[model samples]
Target: MRIKYSIPIVFFVALVIIEKENNIISRVSDKLALKQTPQTPVQSSRSANTLPKRNVSVTSQGKLSSAFMLMKRRLEDYSDYQPAAAVTTRRKNILLLATTRTGSSFVGEFFNQQGDNMFYLFEPLWHVEKMLTLETGGTNATAAAKAYRDVLQKLFLCDFSLLESFIDPLPVDHVTASLFRRGSSSSLCGEAVCSPFVKGVFERYHCGNRRCGPLNLTMASETCLEKEHRAIKSVRVRQLEMLRPLAEDPRLDVKFIQLVRDPRAVLASRMVAFAAKYKNWKQWATDTDVPIDDDEVKKLKSNCNSIRMSAEMGLRRPEWLRGRYMLVRYEDVARFPMRKAAEMYKFTGIPFTPQVKAWILKSTQASKEAGGIYSTQKNSTEQVEKWRFKLPFKIAQVVQKVCGPTLKLFGYKFVTSEEMLTDKSISLIEDIL
Candidate 1:
């Protein structure tokens, strides 16, 4: 599966020679049925950089080059999703609603790897969180919520003009190199949208790995229109109610999937991933004696309350959320990725492509944390129990005391002591009804 992308090849004449190689993806996609097949990784017949060039008949100015069109043809290898092509090709929006340090990034891969059909954005709200200011209290939060929803709704509809306003050092002529995490999205990285001429990208293993010119929001919008599905993953929006308007929009068909993790694990993870913000938690970690009544703990209490309340709202299935809400636990996905991923796709009413399946197989079994805290690749099974050994018994007890109901609601079990916490033999996840 690890074919070095820099395979020596001559691009003279743009001679197209990709038919054999293109079939590899389709064949691989066909092999991944719902049953637990052998989880062996599939290798490509040739490197992507060497795709044979052909002249595409341009019906409209929107039609891109042979390299890009041929790529779209190859990417249309929806092996597992063929029967649902009509359903899958519809314009659908997905909002991965979650809080930080909750493995939302990892879960996002489930949609991000849907190949060419998916237009995925990672935390577009990061721009809003930075450039906007509001009142210093609850009023500030309400404004921020509406602002986030406004931007997200526009983004879901393939409109980026509004997002440009929030971006500092704004893009000129709708083009800028300043899109936060632009590399995280495939549609933005693809040749058709990455730049006027992006045939060079075919040289890489995937669009995500390709180096593209400055992002032109004009091209991004056009590219998004060509995509069948658009997904945005953000931990910025904490409450389900904040996005009720988006879910109800007549112009958008949106689904909400809320990702939550055990609060003790979330606190343990935040201390490492967001070191600056969690300095107090880190200090408490070293001392192994947390101030259960401290403001920091109270903040944790508020976070737990918000998360639990949000989960309750989704679970309640309010009229606005009928057939549109799904609440997922990070622990369950880490433990059983394939099963959980299938359920997620089912909820979203999309097909699970081979690209996603292959990614999960390769990524979940990683030997090390590749990209540090934000990395999606990890030994997922090991990650599930990692916080148990890291979180001090006393500190964990404090979180348990404060987030007790939250943990119970999410099916996380409490441990009595360090011995019980560190014991890998016992399971800490209770099955939720």
Candidate 2:
């Protein structure tokens, strides 16, 4: 005799919607439980254009912001890490960590375009909810470690095939084909079609699976693993503590490549990009209590703060983060992209072939190698000193006043309003903005 099982359709649908909204659904097996469930992508097309609106309520915003910051701090506990075994051989692993708007997108594109075997997905981890919840209730180091471990286990051990099944309704057939093609089990898939989830799954697998050795991803059957199946074992690989324990795992070979840029330039671009969600600099300076209508200012502050925090917190985590990380300044990259790319390539232990170097140079010419290193567009050198003119005096002064010490700590010298336009400070300001 067989037992009969039935799940209420509406309840099932609700469960699916919750999972999708929370970005927790992974593993093809989950589809077994979620079959016949109705679902939609949490982020609609319109939502993509909208930044998570900053709450106008300072009390609530501050609380939430504080929470996420605390979570971020908790995560930092595992930054100081060393591989388990001593090695005579030297190798490189790369990870690029940057706050949004710090030129990470370009750096990712540059790597994907030019680096051999490197893949890029624009904002692959653009999980708005998770990012917004960077602050959560958690305790001290031991407690945080336990919580992180749990989260890591959940993420790493989850099944992803089910999550992909939920996405079946999406108009991503073309993307799927582009990613998976008709292939034998041994080949690596292309980047265009694979979601970041898929990429992460594979990376986690390659990192932890004892069957695979260092610098060897040439296994045939390994490449054919389905998306969800991969996620089941790789989902939580992102947690710092979990990653810390596995730092010595020989099965994983990974590296970090961080990118950065001038905060001023980043602020300028954000004003146009996020104008809808935040207030302008002038408006923001006047009132920190209310949410601004300008996306520009919101994005600028967020990006600047995130970058600063990443540099302060994330980059400095070599202790718990293992030796698999490297920071690449956007200015250094923008000025000498090829050289920096070469440096990055070396850091990642990915050999910089002439072909790769040429490709990097060709793609980066407009963004970095052109005559004026400080220009707005890399090809135009005259735009460097334009930010002082672009930003109102009061606003610029405020930004300088607010961010000056931090900026100077990171090697930026604040210019007085009077010196901003003069010949003496023009070149310095130009190089920065």
Candidate 3:
């Protein structure tokens, strides 16, 4: 009975061994078949190129392990995929270079009213003049020039923090106060991203309080980097050479708008405004006894020379300017604000939208009704010729003599003695004043 049971068990063990050997052979045969299979060109080359190189040892592993390795390789390839081409967005940087009282304030105000997307700074470099005092020559002037350019570079990059080293809002002078007010209203300091310090000062100042208090309103570098358009209006810079470095920087997309006004008109406007402030021309004149005309004539000559020098530089560097520089006359802008504004927007890469048009119309209308204190708000054809009448016939002749070359270059025609007398009858500057 023991021998019969042992014989049955041996047969059962042999059968189990045979079944196990058969299963091993079947798996080996399947793997060999897969290895020997012909692959299409795409599967053999393209897939191999895209996928990470497989280890021969990994391929020799069991099917489950090999399948998992293939999946992981595919995911790695997908994560590493990058397009050969890319699209990038570049911001527009604009510099408005002009002399003081040349209607730059009005132009800057127009840009400022464009709402959030536009970052407009009015006379940002005025602080340099205030700190260094342009009247002092030598090292102070040299230092101020360098500082001016440095400030411009930082401002263009949207790094307002650099300004704090030189500018302080607590002093409450016109320059400081204006900068503080402008900074407070800037869309760059919107509630979402504004620092606690800026928010506090803004709130306090908005409540009709003049004091700015202790405020740290410098913008983060990233905030400035994200701005769509950045613009600076400067009367402090007299030469284009001062800005050439900024224009040539490959990283910055810079365009320049050179604002020019008739020298006679500018002189007349300056004298009248000065006379009004001091109650007489003597207070502001270099020589108190000198007639207003003589004092203004000397100024006109100096101012015209500076303007001509800048214009001559532009002429010499025509290729450098190309599409980068635009010349806009105050007369043209004043006479046809909407039309000129559209052209300006096009040059600066700013869209001439309905909103901008509406603002222009509203602002120009208000300016006509209520002339501003420092600058005229009136945007009318009559505004241009008002200077002809405001300057006395003798003074106008003197200005034409001193500034004739610049006047001709800018296309400003001289008014005949008869025309000057006729315009003097209808002059509105005195009336408006």
Which candidate comes out best when scored by lDDT?
1
Predicted candidate 3 versus true structure: per-residue lDDT over 57-93, tens digit per residue: 2222112232222222322232121223221235778
Model 3 residue runs over 4 Å out of place are 1-89, 134-142, 169-215, 220-223, 276-299, 367-371, 418-421, 424-433
Tell me how many residue pairs clash in candidate 3: 0
Provide the lowest-lDDT 10-residue window in model 2. Answer: 228-237
Q: In model 2, where do residues sit more than 4 Å from their true spots?
A: 1-93, 127-250, 282-306, 313-317, 367-388, 418-433
The sequence of per-residue lDDT tens digits that candidate 1 reaches over residues 1-26 is: 23443343334223345665666774
Q: TM-score for model 2?
A: 0.49
- Tell me the TM-score of each prediction against the true structure: 0.75, 0.49, 0.65
lDDT of 1 at 24: 76
Which candidate leads in TM-score? 1
Ranking of all candidate structures by their TM-score, best first: 1, 3, 2
- Indicate the worst ten consecutive residues by lDDT in candidate 1: 34-43
Q: Write the per-residue lDDT of candidate 2 for residues 1-433, one digit (tens) a residue.
A: 1223344666789998998865554334233322322212212222223223222111221122322232233323322343343332343323345554555544654444443233322221222223223545322334343443433222222222322222222214222222111121112334322223442223322322123221211222223232211111111122232345534546335554445555665565555556664344535545553243345444444345434443443433445444565445565566666766665655554555676566555555564555332222343233334454555445555455334423542444455555563443334321221
Ranked by lDDT, top first:
1, 3, 2
RMSD of each: 20.5, 19.6, 26.9
lDDT of each: 0.73, 0.39, 0.58
